[model samples]
Target: MLSGERLSAIRAKVNRAQCSQNKKSATLSSVSINGDRITERKKESFKTANSFIIRGKIEENETLTKRGERSLNCAQQRYVVVVNGKAHTVFTHRCRSRHCQNCQRIKAFVWQEKMKEIIPELSINFKNGKYLFITFTVKNPKITNLRLVLKCMSRAYAKMFQRKAFRFVVGGIRSTEITRGKSGDDEAHPHFHAIICLKTTYFKKENYLSADEWGRHWGECLEAEFKKEGLEYNAADYPKGFPRVDIRVAKSADGKQEITNKNIAEHGDQLINYVLKYSIKGSDLLKDGKADKWFWEFDKQVKGIRMIAPVGVVKKMLADLERDQFDYYKEQEKIEKLIADDVNFKADKAVFKKEDDFDYYMESKKDRFQYIIEAIEAKAYNYQCYYKALLSDHLLAFRSGIDGIIENFKKIKNTKTREGFEILEKAEMGLVKIQCERIERLQFICDALVRVGLYKKMSDFEYVNIHTKDKTTIAKNNIVGVMKAVEEKLLNDFNQDFMRLENAKSQDVFNTVVDRVNEKSALIKLVRNEILAAGAYAYDADNCEYIDLETNERLEVIATIE
Candidate 1:
């Protein structure tokens, strides 16, 4: 009912709006999730550390680039979840590097949660146990000797704990922290923070270790260990002929009360977090945005070394708990595997083992289209149909299997269980393989159709929008681009097999040629489908597009037949 000019103006507005929407969708789809993109303040935590490591001069290590890349890409891909009508980005992949700030935060949180459970259990088990917060330190060592100093310190700690004077104390937790000492940039001050569990009887005159005695015992142990490590320990360098050791009653966050078993769970959070914090503080590492000599040395010194550990009773209890959790997961995996294997067995029997008349029909037919179709239908069935079904069945079982594992993981995420995140990762990997395999199969069909002149090979449509973020170019976005990339990867081998298949005339030779194609198809499947369904670009073959695995949709793409 509107005038022509008004209608034209309105249509123009709608077209502009749609173009804007498409652009926004393309940008959002470049990341892990799509749909009204949730924006949040991302912490640039890895920037400083990653720059430091990659820039710092180190011995020729093969893993340096891989390490840098992992850290650089950590948490870049995130899954979007909606809660209460609000969208938020959830946790994704992490490098788990020693100095990664994000990983450190997660590690500290897990430890804090663990201590909440452990402290209360230990307190109840050892009714008369008294908790003591202890700090064991040594005179600053040259930066070059930091690794040796840490090794000696660990040995000394172990030796001191095993001494007869320490018999009254049960097990505890120990964590190492290193700092650039005030002495100079070339010196390192490494120390241990421990929450020691002691029997109430330690307060008695006979079993108690005086402040001076504790220092002396620690000094003796350190001297012995330093000597064993072939390093000279000069008592003259330290005040009072020994390094200083600080001892105090473990207190709640509010300093009003000492933490006992009854209050440990509630009060132990602060102490636990402090003890389980990162080995080197971020402020120390990224101070002045410079990677100094001390920082570089510290990174090398602590490589592959464990900075935190449980001792004595704490060690035993945790080990038992882990073992129990492991057994539970193993039992669950066994049951799931049995069920999955049975299902896969039945599927394989029904599909591959059962004979069909399709091959006979192909043997009798003279048409190349029918032969190619029959070859495709048979080879494709054997190529991945069972594998896909098996993986799909396994993926479902893995999700069901990980319920208990996920709960346990919540309590302590670093705990590795075969049936936990590992299985989930495997299932996800299988899914990516299936996606790639599905695309490969479709490409194979389309190529065969093109050979027979039923479908046309086309080019001219870009599968993804040209976009950039932070100066890094993202890979292709949609399924069509992914399929083309996959095709290119397998192009050489595919060329050889495809040419041979095209020359075949006899049915026996045809089956043999198709076998080669099947062999190449089964060789490998891609796993880069993280942003698979991000774009609306579907592969174009004769103006027909296959959008989803189940639905074949017709899309008129801007393309020219080749």
Candidate 2:
């Protein structure tokens, strides 16, 4: 099914990617600080005097709350988990503040991963799709007017996208970058860097737009937006014509090689990284190791602006990718849960095999608990990853666990005999016991997070794990009580059915009523027995009634088990 050339290309790409990852890991290890692999770039950005000055500025801002200040100071300490001499950052406690360079790095990495997923699908789905890197710019505006310039640019971008000449454009990823001019911070140079996906036919004469044509269209759009906003557009000020708009094929960072459909899967990262790069260069913000008035104003101007966006088909593709990823993780969690509870299950050592098998520590525990911890620590470092792929959000996890309990409770009514009812009740309890084990796993992970400094205090763990356990416990008891009530009502209806049988005019009719009563009575007994076995109720054989486990109150027996 595969051509040799393509298959070899893929294998080569895989090897290259592996080598890149190994190199990055080595770089991180070399710069490790306090058990964390904080890169020199990130350290310079976050630990420098500039960051402190920025924090001070944030404090002076009267609009920011106490919580907001704390968030702005996020990632003061990095939290990580160590496995086999390697460190992985599980939590950076990022505030995602516009002024934070570390968060910008994290955001870029997230977009890189997204592009890896999006590119291949787009290539396969839209066979004729090709990429073009375009830059649209306007004349320099004063720093004070930068916000207004950005607004006009956004409006113009929307207008251009709807034009007839751009009909072949499926979608694009656009990012706005602002820089300071040579004259200093007084003037701002704002521009857009976009990688647009276009149909192959766009290269034809009918659809193609040359560099001058693109500049003209962009200039017209800007003029229209400026007029709409009641700002004067003076064409005579620019004797050289409208602002320049550069349009070219997407290429490598060095601008030597073009990325075609065939090679996009391997080289698309270059194009993606360029477009999703930092909105403002770090040097521009931290000039001379100080926060200038212009820097602070720029931060406020772009406070809530989305730096990068995927439009049209790109947006839809991203949504579909997210849903698929969600379902995939959910199914993986289900499988791992099943494997964790299988008493006789042994993790295949082959899966954990490495170059030095003798150094492996995962075999230290006999139970599947060790296997689970190994899988968790090896795969995920942060609680966000843990929650997304394994544990889910607290409320959602509790609801899912309670739902499992109720589904098992409902199956009790399918039993047809007293002995079968007792057996099924025991089996269902065994299943619910597995759900309880997950709650224990949640506690284990919470303790690990608190120990690693992700959670500031043990009380945080209690608030999550303890509160969830209490809610689940309450729901379980309530469902058990409801099961008991339903069983009682069903038995009463059966008794009436039996009484009506006594007045049957024929022996056949009486025998039919007796069979129905036996079936209904067995189902009621099954439901009642399950409630008792759940420990929510206990049978007081002497009084021939059920006792509530919590309140110690007596409840009428629904159906006796012979």
Per TM-score, the best of the predicted structures is: 2
Off by over 4 Å in 1: 1-44, 49-62, 77-89, 323-562
Each prediction's Cα lDDT score?
A: 0.56, 0.60
lDDT of 2 by residue, 208-298 (tens): 9988888888889999988887776777655547778888898766777777666778777878887888787767765675656776677
Can you list the residue pairs that collide in candidate 1?
Answer: none
Clashing pairs in 2: 90-381, 90-382
Report RMSD (Å) for each prediction in the order shown: 24.6, 16.2
Instruction: Please name the candidate that would achieve the greatest lDDT relative to the true structure.
Output: 2
- Model 2 spans > 4 angstroms off: 1-40, 47-73, 79-88, 237-240, 252-257, 323-555, 558-562
